[model samples]
Structures are given as structure tokens and as C-alpha cells.
Target: MDEPVLEVRDLVKHYPVRNGLLRRSTGAVKAVDGVSLTLDRGKTLGLVGESGSGKSTLARVLVGIEKPTSGQVLVDGEDVTRLSQAGRKQLRRDVQMVFQDPYTSLNPRMSVGEIVGEPFAIHGITPAGGRRAAVGELLELVGLDPDHANRYPHQFSGGQRQRVGIARALALRPKILVCDEPVSALDVSVQGQVINLLEDLQEELGLSYLFVAHDLGVVRHIAHDVAVMYLGRIVEQGREAEVYDGAQHPYTQALLSAVPVPDPSVRLVAPSLVEPVETGVSTSSTSGGVGGGAIVLEGDPPSPVDPPSGCPFHTRCWLAPALPEAQPDPIPSYPPTDRPDAGLRLVPAVCETDLPALVPRPEVGSAAAPGDVPAAGPGAASHVVACHFARGLAAPRVEV
Candidate 1:
């Protein structure tokens, strides 16, 4: 097997919080905590999560827009986190990013040609028919009219502007594209065109993509593998079929359950295991889909500045009650007040004390029989879940 073109090993990105007039360091926002994944050449890895789950932060780190707090980002076999100035510039040539918002990503002042050709100027490389011809070729490649190369960004539609962004990203002919919700800002119809364009480009160019988005439907359509992220950590990951068909993690199950189904007659039922809670926070499309019965979590995700101990998702996990008995004792109430019920309800002691590792579950996969654990294949070992009771949890029925 060919080596993965991109690999992330326990990547961690954090932002420090400051307090007082002296600007004392108070705490840190634990965004992109201990993330690990591999993107094989010419394959798309779709990253799905909620709004503040640090999806964008991980994308930025991969494309060199933000430095990681710790951990390794390996491009090919080389570690990019510790690259020198010149090495960093070369890294830019190897990895590129497509920003989410088309309106803000491109400079309105510059013509489309200048925007796309800017990479050549920065890298100091003149193309074979000169920069003008090369820019025109790139514009054509992304389905934009070369004649419009002289036109400014404001003259184009949102989708057209995004094509311009893609053309720009391809200017350096980078090996990997870190697309951060590239279609989120476009209309539904235009989004399909853009996604199809990306697919065609990947087949034609042998490009590897790290596709990040909130829409599970889009991910299901475009991604070969899917990784479910929550509160900066990947709770579950597997091949698209394995994940969509046999999700074990409670978080993954909830996300899959919320994906909108097209059949109007098929009534959506809330998963039997999940007991919906009314936490003032709206139970909207947390995963960016509409029309299905959502597994509405209790309360909003905890603040990254002070993430809960043990499992990060334990606070929101609906399966905690069904797990084994809490070891030691349940967590004490906050403020350490005299009353035992002074703060939040007690969770399973184990869930509140020990973090779960992402480990393989041979029993869970696309090919496994209902209630039967399949023998672990080379690919099946990659189907991993971070929940402690992953093996005990039954595969979630998504389309009921």
C-alpha cells in the first residue's frame, strides 16, 4: 500500500485566556485536542462536527495558517510543525487551503487573474506560457471563463467567486487541499456544481483532500472515510460505509440520526436509547442538516477554556446511564458546598474520571451481521470509537 500523503499525530491547538489588568494567563481553549488521522493520496477524508468543535481550527493548522500548540503534522514523511522559514514556504507549495467564505477570502480590488496568479509571484515561479496564460488555464480548469479573468470578484456570483478561490489554491499545484466548508456559503444548486468540480479535479489531478463540513449528507456523498469530531477530539472514525452503517459511539449515532432523509412518508423517530433533554439551548441542526428527529443534547458544548475532565463528550452523552456502574463514586457537586445536590447532576464516575482512547471495534463495520462481531480485516481495524462502552452499545438504526 502507498504511504499516506498526509498524517496528523495527536495534533493539539490551544488559545490562552487572559484576565486582570496585568493580563495574567488564566486558562486555555482546548481546540483541536489530540487529533490523529491519515489522508491517503487521492482520497477525501470528511471531517464532520458541530459549530464550535474546532473543525476550522484543525484545517487552519494543516494549511499553516495557525501553529499547533503541540503534536505533529506530517506532510509526506516530513514533520511540518518544526519547519524553518524556507521550509515553511516550501510547505505552502505542498499544501493549500480553500477558505469557507467566498466574499471575504478574495480581495475585491484584484482582478480574478491577479488573485489566481498571486501564488506564482509569491513563489517566484514563471509558468511555461507566462503567468497570464497559466492563470487563464487555471481559471478554465475550475469552470470559470478565462475571459472573465480581468474582472473583479464583486462581478461574479458566490459560486463563481468560490471557483476563483479554488483556482487560486491550485495555482501552486499543491499536493493536499484543506477545504474548510468550501461549499457552506453557496446556494444549494451551486454547491453541487462545486462539489462535482472538486471530484473531477481529484480524479484528474490525483489530489488528496481534507474536506471539513457540518453537512453529513455532503460528506456521505463525497468522502471515502468519515471522522466524527466533538469538542476538538475525534470521537469516531471509519470508512464511509462502516461509519454510516455501524456507528458505535453515542455521539456518532446522534449525528447520523440527524441526517435528513428524502422520503416524506418515512416518519422519523428519535433513537430509543437517547432521551431528549430541554436545555435552553435550541435543538437545531447542530450537524447542519434539517428534517430528521435530532438527538438533542443537553446544554451547549462545554467551554474549551475549561473542558470537562475524563471523556470530553461525557457531559452531553445520553448513553452514560446505560454504561457499567460508576467506579469509586459519582463526581461531587461544584462549589464544594454542604449540599450534595448543589450543582450539575452526577455522571458515571468512570466517565468523569478516565478519558477513552480511540480503539478498533471489529464487531462494528459495514459487512458485519446484526449482533455479530465480524473478524477484523486490515481495513476493519481502522473502524475505531472513543467511547468506553462502544463494544456494548448496539449499532444505531439511523433511518427508522
Candidate 2:
């Protein structure tokens, strides 16, 4: 953690919205607004969000494919955002991208060898031994046969073509790889293999990854840290467990609710995006948001172009301030916990009124999740969340 391999600060990407016969600009699409994160050297930071949440745009900006409207990208503590063309070339080569959609990413007419070795051709980099040998080494490193490099992209399966893409990304011996939903398109079985390959490579070569995907389950397994993006901004980010298990924001809770649970017997009461929380249910859905526990978020996410004032999630947040102070308490806790182990009671007003800052805190201890995000409170010792109720700062804790 001394010097992060990549640090993206307050990044923003806005696209003008065109309309009418003249095709004039009417508005702008807030793809990414004020996203800041640090990718540690030799670690994976998973970027998970719903589609159109700007995960890909951030990835593109990291690799120099898309310039940010504002903010900076620092590589090795040096600003790459203001670098010239030649400097960008050096930065781009050091940080490669494995694009989404293998079918389209690789040219159908080109042979695997040509696509993988194209970097050498473009950058005028001829390996010591030969270009052919370097390409072969790249293919083998990704678990593909070197001889098959002569075959066209169409001849290989979706997974194989993806491996080719990986080979291409590794062609330049990059220090970091920006993968945009690399496994979403492949079969379920193939997805595991590719994920394993990434892990193995990370261990063997000490590569850093900025992995973008919508699957929280996959993200949980591979990522050391997680950033939860909503609309165009990062609603919550911290250590993987801190954001998921110790979520202080309603949006983060809603996202965790959507991840299907392997078991169905457990039922949880979810929060309503547009309605205030009812009086009896426990606030913290202790059982991980599913089964006997659920935290359903009511209503849809609002448009990003014109986000609500105060809190962007206020419009659909179930923790709305509309409910009277004396309203009936159907669910006392967000994920009402009946067991003694359940930790931290959530404060509704603070969550709905002000946006929750992404602060690392010691996670609430539990059997299923060990040392993950604590249900609440800030600690001087380890990563912990400091919600109003947990830290005795904002909303006072109430008995369920």
C-alpha cells in the first residue's frame, strides 16, 4: 500500500444527449461522476454495478482509451491524465485492457497469432528471439496451444477467443489489466476456468486487475476490495466485506438483496426505495440478505442525468424522511435480527438525508462472515463502518 499501482481520482465522463431533427444537444448522460479509487499493487479491485452504471467508462479511462472530463489518473504516483501523446503510449502499454465481447473484440479475419502479436507490430517491439516465439509464449501462458495461434478467431469457442484476448492483453507484459465483464458472455463452466486462470496469473506474475462485472458472487470470490457504483457515482466502496456486509448506504443494501441466494427457506424483509421502513422487522438482515431474511428495495433507480438533490438515492430510498416520527414500527431493524449475534441497528434518517461516505471500519463479527464489514461503528484497530447508530454519532440505536 506504499505507492498504489493505479489511483483514479474524482473521475467524470459525460456524454451530450442529442435530440430533434437538427440533432442538437439537449442534455448530457452522467456516465461517471466523481469516482475515486486506488488499485493497490498486486491486488484486485472489483467494480460491480448495474448496466449503464459507468463501470466500463472508468475502465476505459484507466487504460487511456477514454479521457476523463475531469480528474486525474496517477500511475506510480505520477499523473498520467496530463501526459502527452508519447507519454500516453507508454502508459497505455503498461496498463492493458481485455475488452468485453470476445466476438467483436477480436477481428474475424485475423489469425490468433496476428491478433496477439499485433501489439508487437504496432509498437515496433520485436522480442529478442522472434515475434513468433513471443506470441507462442503468450498463448501458452493463457492455457492455449501455441500452434492454434494460426487459426482464425471464428474457429475458437467463446472461451477460447477470450483466452486469445487475454494473450493479447498480456502481449505487452503489462503491470495492470483492465477487464470489462470478461466472463459474463461465456458458459457457466467456462466462467470458473477463466476466473481460475486470472487468479493463478495474479499469483504467479503479481499482476493487478481492475475487474468490472455485475455478478456480485463472482466479485466476492475474486476481488480483494469492492466498489459499489450506483447510477453514475460510487455509492459505497471499501474492503469487499465492508461494503457488502457492513453497508451503510441503502443503495448498497438494495444491490446485495438482488444477488440470488443458494438457499430459499430463509426469508428477509427488504427496504423500500420509495417507502419508509416499517416498525417490527430487524434493521440488519443478519443472514446475508436472503432466505429467512430479505431486504427488498422498492421502486426503480432514478435517472442519472438529473439526480435528486441532497442524496441521489433519496427519490427511491425506503428510508425516506416522509414518515412521521411516531409512525408504526413494523420492522424495527432493516434486516431485523432475532439472534443474539446480529449486530448494529440502522439509523434511517441519516441514510436517507445525507449520502453515506465510503469509510473503512472493523466489520461486525459473525459466524458466516468473519472479519467482514462490521454491522457498525468505527475502530482505531481495523476496517470498520461508522454509521450513525454504530458510532454513536448520528442516529441513536433503538431496541428492536
Candidate 3:
């Protein structure tokens, strides 16, 4: 199999929480914790999750904008995490990022030409026909008029400004693009145009993309592979078809259930393991069979600085109650005296005690016999999920 253009192994990025006049290190915001994935050459990997799932943080770490606390980020088999200053400069050329907001990403003071040509100046590379000509070509390549190179970012529409950002990212002919929700800020109509432009650029430049977004619909349109993240961990990952057609994790199912379905006749239902608790906040229950209503997850995500002891997602997981019983293991930090008075709820004890490993599932069309696990590697069709009860819970695929 051909090598992956980018590979992240157990990547972790944390922000230390400081307090007191002395500014002592207290806890860390566990952003992008133990994230592992591979982005194959010329393919797009859609990283989807809710806000604060650490998607953007992971992207920043990948593109060298932020340093990771631990783990490896390999570019063409070479670990770039601990490179020298000069090596890091080369790493920047190899991997560039398209920021989320077009309005703020570009320098309002600089013209489009200057913004696009800045990479050449930083790298000290002179294009064949000078920087101006090269910038003009990039502007045209992203569907903007070549003459618009002289225009500032403020003069362009939201979509056009994003195009300028893309042009700047492509200025150095980078091998990989870490697009951190690049189209989320644009109008709905213009979003498609930007997505199409990205598709065209990827095919033309042979660029591999790590497209991060909260919108599953956009990801479904462009991604060849899908990785569903929850609370800084990938709960499920597989090929586009495997993930969209046969998602096993409860979080993935809930996320897919939330995708807007245009048809009025079709309904979306997310079955819960226990009776819906009355928390004032609206929640959704199973509407008879599995077919449309959003699975309104109860409670906000736990604080990253003080994440749950076992599975970070176990608190809100709907499938936890269905699993078999195990010994209870309470969190050491939150003793009975310190626990919240939300009352008690029934869930599998193991769900709060053991963190399940993201293991490959049994192959499609085959019975999951004991010890029958698929091997995960490049080009392998292994559907990996990090749920203890994933083997018994075969979630119905929801087409967006």
C-alpha cells in the first residue's frame, strides 16, 4: 500500500491551567488527547465533532501553529514533532493551514497579492516570473480574477476572502492542508462553492486534506474517510462508507441523527438506554422505530481540565445502561461529599471504571466470533470504535 502523507500517533495537546500570584501550574485542559489517525495521500479525512472537542487544537498542532504535549506527527514517515528550527520551516512548507474565519485570518492591511506572496518572502524563494505573477496565478487558480491580487481582504466578500486564504495556503505548494472549518463562517449558498473549489484544488494539486468541521453534511460531501471525535478522543473511525453506513459508537449515531434531513416524511430517532431525565433542557427520545428527531444529548461536555475518570463520554452516553454489570469504581477526585446533587442514575459500572480501547471491529458480513478482530493499517477496511458494548450495538446508518 502507498504510504500515508500524514500520520498522527497518540497525539496530545494540553493547556496548563495556572493560578495564584506565583502562577503555579494546576491542571491541564486535555485538548486533543491521544488522537491517532492516518491521512493517506490525495485523500480527505473529515474530523467531525461538537464545539470544544479539540478539533481546531489538533489542526493547529498538525500545522505547526501550536506545539503538542506528546505523541508523534509523521510527515512521509519522518516525525516532525521535534524538528529543529530549519526543519520546522520546511515542515510549514509541507503542511499549511486554512483558518476557520476568513474575516480575521487575512491581514487587512496587506493586499491579496502581498498576502499570497508572503510565503515566498519568508522562504526566500523567487518564482519564475516574480512574486506578483505567481500570486496572480494562485488567485486565478482559486477562481478569483487575477487582477484582484491588488485588492485588500476587506474589499472581498466572505467567500472571496476565504479563496484568498486558500490561495495563500497553496502559495508554497504544500503537500497537506489542515482546513480548520474553512467554510463554516460563509453563507450557506457560498459554502458549496468553497467546498467545490477545495475539491478541484485537491485533485489538481494532489493535496491531502484534514478537513475539520462540526457540520456532518459538509464532511459527508467531501470526506473519503471519517473520524468521529468526542471530548478529545476519537470514538469511531472508518472509511466514509463504513462510518456513514455502519456506525457503531453511540456518539457517532447521535451525531448522524442530528444531520438535517430535507424530506418531511423521514424522521430521525435516537433511542436512549434509560428514561429521559427532566433537566429543563429539551431532550429527544426514540420515536417508535429508528428512522427522524435529533438526539438531544443531556448536559454539556465535562470540563477538559477535570475530565471524567474512565471514558470521558460515559456521562452522556446513551448506550452505557444496556451493557452488562461490573464492579463500581468511583472517581477519586469527586468523592461522595463533592459529587453533584443531580441524584443517581443507572449505568454500567464498567462504563465509569474502564476506558475502552479503540479496537477494530469484525469485518462486514462476518459474525463477530470471540477473538475475531480485523487488523487496522493502511488500506484496511477496519471499522474501529472505542465502546465496550459496540460489539452488541449495531447502530442503524442514517443517510444525511
For all predicted structures, in order, the TM-scores are 0.84, 0.80, 0.87
Comparing 2 and 3 on lDDT, the stronger one: 3
RMSD in angstroms between candidate 3 and the native structure over all alpha carbons: 7.2
TM-score of 1: 0.84
Q: Give the TM-score of candidate 2.
A: 0.80
lDDT of 1 at 332: 35
lDDT, candidates in the order shown: 0.79, 0.72, 0.79
- Give the higher-lDDT candidate: 1 or 2: 1
lDDT of 1 by residue, 242-302 (tens): 7887677777766765666775323233233333333322344433112434555557899
List, residue by residue over 1-400, the lDDT tens digit for candidate 2: 3347999887888888899999999888888887878789999999988787889988888898888889888988889989999999998789999988989999898999999999999898999889999999999999999999889999999999999999999988899999999999999899999999999999998899999998888998899888878777776667776555555555666666666665543322132322234532233444333343455555566677776554566556555444554653322433444533354444445534444444444323433321233343334322333233333211111111
Off by over 4 Å in 2: 20-24, 266-293, 321-357, 360-400
Model 1 clash pairs?
none
